[model samples]
Target: MINWKVRFKNRSWVMAFVAQLMIVAQMLLQGLNALGVTDFQLTDAVQQSILTFVNAVFILLSLMGIVQDPTTKGMSDSERAKTYKEPN
Candidate 1:
C-alpha cells in the first residue's frame, strides 16, 4: 500500500500534480461548455488569472522543494548500504 504522507512529502510533486489536474479540469470544462451544459468561457482576464496562478504556485513549490534539507530526504543508496551494513 502506498503511504500518503510519504507520497505527499515533496512540495514540488504536489504542486506539479495540482497544476496538471487543473489542465485536465480545464479540458473537461471546455468539453462541457461545447456541449452547452455550461458557459465556461476562456476570456482574456480569466485565462491570465488562472494560468498566472498555476505558474506562480509551481514556481513556489519548486523553490520550497529545492530549499529543503537533504537529511529529511530518504538516504542515498551508498549511505543506506553503509548505515545498514548490507552485503555487497
Candidate 2:
C-alpha cells in the first residue's frame, strides 16, 4: 500500500547496488591478496586496519539503505502468502 514512487524518487539505487557488491569485492580482494595476485604496499596491520574501517562503513551504509528503502528488503514470507488468499 505504500507509494514507492515517491519513496525512491531521488534514491541512489546504484550506490546501494555498489555497496552490496563491495562485500563480494572485498572477499575477492582478500582472496587475491592471499594468492599474491596483487601487490600490497602497506604493512599487514595497516592494510587490515584500513579494510576493517572501510568494511564497517560499507556495512553501516548498506544497513541504512535496506532500512530506508522498502524495495531492497522485499516483502516478508507471510506477506507474500497473504497476497494469494482467496476471498470467501
Candidate 3:
C-alpha cells in the first residue's frame, strides 16, 4: 500500500499531483467541448504547450528522485565525496 502522508510531504510529488490534475481538467474540458456541452475550447497550440510543460516537469522530478536515492543516507562523507568528482 502507498503511504499518502509521506508522499504528500514531498514538494516534487505535490507538484506532480497538481500537474496530473491539470491534465485531467484539460481532458474534461475537451470532452465537454466534443459533446457540445460547452462552447469554450482550447486551441491546439495551448493544449500542446500544457502537455509539453507537464512532460518536462515529470522528467525533471524523476531525475531529482534518482539523485536523492535512499542509499546515499548510509554513505560516509569521504565515500560521498568520492562519488562526485570535482570539475576540472
The prediction achieving the highest lDDT against the true structure is 3
Write one digit per residue (lDDT tens) for candidate 3, span 1-88.
3345555666755776776677688789878999999998668899789778877876786677632335445433334344443311
Better structure of 1 and 2 per TM-score: 2
| Candidate scoring better on lDDT of 1 and 3 | 3
Relative to the true structure, candidate 2 reaches a TM of: 0.50
Error of 1 at 55 (Å): 8.0
List candidate 3 segments past 4 Å from native. Answer: 42-88
Instruction: Provide the clash count, candidate 3.
Output: 0
lDDT of 2 by residue, 5-28 (tens): 433343464466566677788789
Q: Please give the range of 10 consecutive residues that has the lowest summed lDDT in model 3.
A: 79-88
Per-candidate clashes, comma-separated: 0, 0, 0
TM-score of each: 0.46, 0.50, 0.51
Q: Looking at model 1, which ten-residue stretch has the lowest summed lDDT?
A: 79-88
lDDT of 1 by residue, 60-79 (tens): 76566642334444533334
| TM-score pick, better of 2 and 3 | 3
